[model samples]
Target: MSPTPEAVDLSQQRALADWLPGRLAAEQPAILVLGDVMLDGWWSGSIERLCREAPAPVVDVQNRESVPGGAANTAMNLAALGARVSVAGIIGTDDAGMDLRNQLVAAGIDVTYLLDHPDMVTTTKIRISSGGQVMLRIDDSARSVPAEALAELAASVRSAVEHQHAVMVCDYGTGVLADPVRRGLVDALAGRDRAEPGVRPLLVVDSHDPRPWAPLRPDLVTPNAQETARMLDLRLPEGQERVAEVSRHADALLEATGAGAVVVTLDRDGTVLLRPDGVTHRTWARPAAEKQASGAGDTFVAALTLARSAGLPLTASLDLAQAAADVVVHQPGTSVCSTAQLSRYLKAFADTALEAGELERQLELHRAQDQRIVLTNGCFDVLHSGHTRYLNQAKQLGDILVVALNSDESVRRLKGAGRPINAVADRAAVVAALSCVDYVTVFDTPTAAPLIRQLRPEVYAKGGDYTPEMLAETPAVEEYGGRVAILDYVADRSTTAVVNKIRDGEGAVQTN
Candidate 1:
């Protein structure tokens, strides 16, 4: 009957969509991230005329801004997703570094581990764009970080791990994720004894090289198709057997690195997650019509951590994480995916199913709503009332409330592993379900400006702790006549304080 349904594609989908919204509403999940963090800068306008001095087309230079890229972007994605995020990484004592710290602090991430390294130039990526698509990118930074800086950063990460729910390493081949720091970070999260489930600190990594990571044996690892191929030293699965090849590669990765699971990202196709059970599940991309794919991966990992922390099964987590990815890929440039966006995507899919290109049409309709959206985002690793009271009140001041979620890499760039208490999808679901939320999105940048411009919200909101003049969002939000609104926050109601209190034995630490 009906071809036996082929595969159970979306039961857990509904559950995941509802999960994060519930978590955000309830206020829970703490995520710790350790790794590289970089500043992503961009200049976008139009090629209205050609440069007189050169053959290159001259852009009108309509806009210029910066956001966290690489691991920092991943942390930002996690924070946007509603995770109680804590970041640990090395930053140069420079303007860019200061900017990065302010971005994290404004988004609700714990920046105690975000260290200051003198003389090190903050890693930054400058992209020149035409319209919304990227044309070229330039990297500015040093390759090897000073040893002393690495040690200090690692120490801060170690301290955070003793109190976090999970550990994620975002390696961008940058100096912050130094070899020694990587090893020590792994050691900190490694299972103490065989009977203890390889330590309560679930180890997750997203790195370029496999050799450095093999010894640590992470709990989860995500690499793009190219990275997977390089890691395995072979051409990955292609054609009909792609799934099998990925599954084999995932198992091989697990065996090689001692990780618990492997999630290989396939561009144009989708993401395939290989379980330790040797099962391979494929989640196809459900991108919105005429959208861009920027910070989609960061959002995926951030939501994934939140989901797992929420006690969701792997399949459910994968389903929801993929759903969150679909939402982010549609936004312009590196952006954040908030719970509202996730919820809208879910509700749209649940109502008409993700078939017949209904989602694309739905997204267009929402954009046409003409609301001055107030966008503020973070990785609510663990949902908490503090976040709720703040978000709920902020939503009341805007026509549509949008949250930008940090990807797992963004989480790591800011927080050392041990974070996004909930998986990405679970976090997205928690925010989506909230009545105050209007749309949710994900970004890989440390700052929400890129996404803010893309959405062009009428208003920007933040916690009472910071004024609009001090906000990194002021420039972007004000450019569009959108005013920045600051909501009053409860004193000491924070993810960092909660995590510290737990470490101090405030109550029982329950993972599930």
Candidate 2:
């Protein structure tokens, strides 16, 4: 049996968080989003009384706004994440279609291929909400696109795919991606020599029912739990059981969807990625929020497509997609995870204390990126200017500076009683907050030799008048071809000196 899929290593998570923003900025991958396009309208107001005609609460509508939905939302998410995005689909020539087109243009998305059909009704969902809860939804959509309109969309998609780096098929069972469009997509993809490496436009399919598009042979397909269950014609149990059932049918799902891989997203249960070779990778969901917004799946697909198009490993792309989805779930309404928001979320991980294993994994990722690692250990019971200055100097020596703090027990063992004014957790937090420090971890050892050997940082830094002979970890560093560097120490900058001054009350004010 394949081993259980573990969460993405914390270090890798940190590395992806740091790498994605810069990569997206430099590449600005052009992605074509095709399939159903719609506008989502929100009518929010106060429900103070019941309506005379019915028992339902009467909503005094106070606000009305519209945003992209379905495939358009997916395109919006791609645009938000710094991708050069264009949308292709069928919409009506009505006001709703015009509104949707305007919104897409305003968000910097190219709508050249978003065709308007005189006979079709623009797919629009108007949801009435009150006090942050959805009350009712009214949908307007055409059952099918005219054959001529479908032909036009297929032609546009064929041409658009030629210039794009990635194509996202967001099929919502709206007939926008009809038989003609699907056939065109298959021909276009096949003509691109997709089997070869470094193809220009990778194809990703996100559909309500993906089995029909099996001929396209997409690189990735994202189907939520319910969608997966429907495709399989079986009821999947909740939680891990659902994940196991999906794993057992991984090969079947691959064959059914004709995708290189399938990611089955389980709301509040994270996601499970299934591949053709029986390899599965899972990402655990963040703690469930009391209430969450919608369209996180679209956010996931957008990030995943962008990451994959940028040549990130498939597993890493999955993790990045999960992180983006996590960002949007906590927000209200249909939301998108912007590049800045995702960066901030990932940076938050750096402030928390990591175990030795996690820290080592993080360092390995740094090494992979050819970044220099600097390691330093101390008992920062109280943060002061001296500590900050020393850390800044240490950071200057390398690309990533890791601060290791002595655990409370170790601090007390070394300094005797009444030492370590703050606990290791608190100390790690303070040290991590320093702009120069990239990561923080707690160590209980009397010396930092174990950590130095495990992390194998390029530079083992210390502050003060200490030579290689004075440090216990010098041999450990030298054994691994690493070097020890001593940074300049400011006068009267010791934590001991600060504690003594406080105890002596030298800086205390005299009361009248």
TM-score against native, each model:
0.64, 0.68
On TM-score, the leading prediction is: 2
Model 2, residue 322: displacement in angstroms?
A: 0.8
Q: Top lDDT: which candidate number? A: 2
Q: How far out, in Å, is residue 443 in model 2? A: 2.8
Q: Per-residue lDDT of 1-512 in model 2, one digit per residue for the tens? A: 11111211112223434656556646788899988998998889998899889899998999988889889989988888899998989999999999999999999999999999899999999899988888899999997779999998877666778768899999999888878999888777766656444664788999999898888778899999999999899999976689789989998899999999999998776788898776666655563466527788899899999887776667656667877888888887777888899878766664499889998998889899989999999998765556665776687677788998898999999988988776665566545644356789988988999989899999999998888899999999999899899988766666776566566755521110
Superposition error at 360 for model 1 (Å): 19
- Poorest 10 consecutive residues of model 1 by lDDT? 1-10
Candidate 2 Cα RMSD (Å): 16.2
- The per-residue C-alpha lDDT of model 1 at residue 210 equals 51
